[model samples]
Target chain A: MHIVDGALSNEVVIAGSVLAAGGIALGLRKLDIEKIPAAGMLSATFFVASLIHVPIGPSSVHLILNGLAGLMLGWAAFPALFVGLLLQAVFFGFGGLTVLGVNTLNIALPAVLVFYICRQGVAARSAITSAVWGGIGGTLSIVLTTLLVGASLALSGDEFIPAAKLVFVTHIPVMIIEGLLTGFAVYLARKVKPELFAELTVSAEATS
Target chain B: MGHIVTSGPQVLVNAQVSGGNRLLDKLDPRTRIITACVYAVLIVSFKSLVVLSCGLALSLAAMQVTNTPVKATLRRMLAMDGFILFTLALLPFTMPGTPIFSLFGYGFSIEGLMKAIDIALKANAIILMLMVLVGTLEPVTIGHALHRLRTPQVLVHLLMFTVRYISVLHQEYLRLRAAMKVRSFQLSNSLHTYKSVGYLVGMMLVRSLDRSERILAAMKCRGFTGTIPLLDTMQFTKRDKVFALMVLFFALLLIVMEWMIDTTY
Candidate 1:
């Protein structure tokens, strides 16, 4: 989730900031005027999605929906998530300013994976298959992000084993929750907003 | 997380703490936001535990003088204590320095404990500054601050709408949960409930989109531009400059103290 400032090393924060900047640049390059509304809508949806809490053992985890964001906005999910997170950090202090880059990259990379995975599955003519891919993608993304956070902390001379174990164990329930949420979200999208799929297909075709 | 559900009293306390005071209320929203941001940066930049402690104490004193209730602040800090504990628990195990004590096959170091305390203090300071800013400033004023900060007009507008719609969405979520409860929907250890939640979210998204379109149309009808005009311009007075300078001076002083301690100790 959100890493507060001073939790990680300054090196990690700087590196994250650099990588996030690159991701934002890459994401912005593919923007089309028509996609602006989609981006806005997706950003708003991402903002709201974090509010719905799913109870875990001691901590409540909410649906990040980064995978769904990927499915909907494709590359644009980067900026959408970034902006959404920035607002959350600034307005509600959900996260920290220095760690913004790391959090965004952690979430957006998986979003990109979901986008590509969904693209391939849709091309294979199976919405359910795509949903499954989306679900797995969402779950793995969170796991990877947690691992990265752990690794970053460990690399900074923090006890690697305990932090790693804590992060990994804490995330198991949340990952399962994310997978379920992603699967159902994709299914619903396919049902109610079939045009979204069609638009993705059209965009893919246009790109090719 | 389940504890958050039982946090109604805590939330009420926090709300009351934030609701107190009219002095901060009188400042321009942009100025308040700038002050908050500056405070966050200054607090984070310092590595000394003492300075962080002092910063936190100063912030609390400001809150107290502004009539912010102690119970409210304590409740808010308690909610955040979970995260702080997580950070603290990691420090003694990971940080390197002269070992102070050994417990349960682990060595606790002075450096680690100090670092952890510093982190906790900085986090608290930032959170306190943010609470004061948000409590004092209106949402529209925040929007104006972002605009003044030269954030993207489109994104600012989106945020404006998003903030406006958040309450509506919260209400919708409550209604949905109530309806589910009325139908005797038992949420248990099953994937089915998650899918239901997802479906609900998807439906909400669609509704929100439709609502946003209507809002856009209405704005256009009223000759709304992409940018929202600020009701009051953010002007920096001599007093504002003096305040800003004082903050900077204290921040530098803290940084110096941290450096001296790190070197001498």
Candidate 2:
């Protein structure tokens, strides 16, 4: 679901880069050094997670887990997503350097959003509810990003209907898959590693 | 050792670019990043195949001037050839064109073939340009560039640390895999294998959280402020300006050339 270089308008690329830069700065301001290793490990997980492709129709789709990252990292997901993307661009060429900022924001924003939503839901009820919220949030976030991407392409003079249809059609199944994956990932975390859920619980408690 | 082997060559290329100068290294990482970003934008704006070829040629020349190894760059591009191959296969069937050849009821169009070639070339050009940028620049430098370019500090710092620790987690993954292997747990079935992988990922998440807590404690001890302070400032020399101008000139040249070709034909 990553947008390749030259696929979008120069305006979007330039403007998106600026916006992403600001997001990164904000993410860095309150970052604690202790969080570095966790960020690193999670970033690595994000990277490795993408390597396993789950087949979807003619084209195969991989798990992005932006929601999971958001739920765990919060705003920290920006940098984690950025690093994972950079590595993917360089090592695997999945995305280009030019579109890095835009792509990072697209994926990471959903993650950050999921973190907030899940935190709120978990405070009022059970872990299962939080997990379900995270899954739904993740799916919605990707859809939002896809729409944004499609809108950007359309604004750049691409035939809006085709571009929108292409993005929406391809991503619907991916979104469902993402929702399931995020739900299961959260469920698995709650089961095998309760400590990992501590931060999410604390954030949820604070928010609620 | 294997990691070193994989990363060493790229590091050497980058070291050469930095040239052991603290001052040069300190220049706004954002400036370089923006320059690269602009180059990518200009390249993708062109639809003509000839212009893309010229753009690729120009990028190669820039790499040469910077002392970047053509072989290494090509090797990296070669590694990503699978995607290019996929694009090539799709283009001929999907792109509109007149039939030039047919095989087993499948028609191949000359126009489609040309367009596919153009897409392939354009894609590679973009990829090569990025490889050079990422290869020569440090992750922190790139992060700093983004900061200067007005990217959110949180995202930049997060990315910086993420790049710093990816290998650490990779090592953790290797250890976990080794342990699993030693226990004689067969991971031959894809479904069972994925489950094991997921569990391992869960364990990794727990370990990562613990590590982050420790890191936060250490940073607090060091009296770290919210922002990472730079030890030096990056100053742009006349040479840097000249370099920037040259890139702009080439981009314009490509655009004009495309215009001329379209009008003439």
Candidate 3:
């Protein structure tokens, strides 16, 4: 889901930077300074988590877990996930620098969307119910992220329309993998540490 | 697709880049950050193949000067190319221009092909330059450098905290995986595999959250209010000034050459 530099038109790049800045600010404002430790550790944890490769068939796909991060952190996923992207770009050269904002927007916006759409469901009384909701949220986040990525590319030029379409189509399997993994992760969190979901809700509610 | 088992070292291995270039390392990190930003922006906006080729050559030259392993650096870049190759390949078919070739019923155009190459050159060059400049720094210095560059204080701190704990938490993650491996856990395409991996991640999140509480308590014990004090004191010395000026001169030369070529063409 990372868009490298020199791919986007100037207008798309500028728009992405502006919108991402706004999202980061909103996320930061929601996160109190005292919560920094938790946010940081969670952010690092997600970075580490993304390294885990779940085998789909002969190949493997690394976890994005943006939806899970959103469920855990609400709006704050924007900044935390942005940090993850930044590290990937710098250390791994997985994404480029100038397109940082666009990549951040593409990955994090759907995360915020997931939080809103599945927050209530993830808070369901039964672990199985919450897991189902988590699966839905996870699937939806990947679906929405693919769309945003396509839109950004397509908006840049008519030439990229096919590539944008391909981006979504190729990621379909990934969507299922992430959804299942997120579902089980949510189930475990629900069974062992229900408070994980509670913290996000309380914070989200208080902020709202 | 690197190994997940040794992710702590995987993330930090590039920090060894700092000692590779004495001249580059001597410059203030702020200079490198600013220079990379400006260079990337300039490279992205460039249209002429001549200009982009020069940018690529220049970045390649920087790599040579730094004693950076040419094979390893270019291999990472090749991986990036793999990511964008499909998109670039589509361009020749998608954009309308003079027909260069035909595949099935579709016509590939010269203009679209040129655009693809242009983008590829720009993308690769900027990434290479970024790796040589900003990517060579220790990750922690990047946080401090951004702070010095007036990045939002809270955001900088967030980056700092993330940088500080990525390795530690990665070690914790490895320990959990080791425990799983001890139980003869096999990663495969199955519900068992998915559930086990998910549980591993969940366990990681739960323990890290608990650890965070202890950290917050420890910070409060040490009278930490909101901000962690900046311990790094970076100075922009004469060498940094000289390097910034050299970068500026290089940018101006590229701009002048591009302008001249654009006008003539």
TM-score winner among the candidates?
Answer: 3
lDDT, model 1, position A65 = 76
Model 3 has a DockQ score of 0.69
Give the winner by DockQ: 1 or 2: 1
lDDT of 2 by residue, B75-128 (tens): 666655654464356445444568777767756767657765765666678777
**Models sorted by lDDT, best on top:** 3, 1, 2
Cα lDDT tens digits for candidate 2, A1-208? 5666655667888888887877665555435554555666677677656654555556566567777777777776777777787766764456676778888878877677667666565333466775677568768777877876666656654323354557777689878767766666666677666555676567434544
Instruction: Note each model's CA RMSD in angstroms.
Output: 3.8, 5.4, 1.9
lDDT string, candidate 1, A65-184, tens digits = 777777666776777788777666544445666677888887887777767766666434467875686678677767777777777667655454576678778788888888778777
DockQ scores of the candidates: 0.39, 0.29, 0.69
Model 1: runs farther than 4 Å from truth? Answer: A25-38, A56-60, A122-124, A158-161, A200-208, B1-21, B68-73, B216-232, B259-264
Best by DockQ: 3
Worst 10 residues of 2 chain B by lDDT: B10-19
TM-score of chain B of 3: 0.92
Q: Compared with the true structure, what per-residue lDDT tens digits does model 3 show for residues A65-183?
A: 99898888888888999998888777666788889999989989999999999999998888899999999998998999999999999999998999999999989998998898889
Model 3 chain A worst lDDT window (10 residues): A86-95
Q: Which lDDT tens digits does candidate 1 get at residues B1-265?
A: 2232243222211222234356566555666777777777777777767778888887787677666556654565556666558857777866677888888877898887887777778777787667656544555567677888876665565555555555566567668888988988766556667878888877776666666567667767877655557566677777566666866787677778778888987
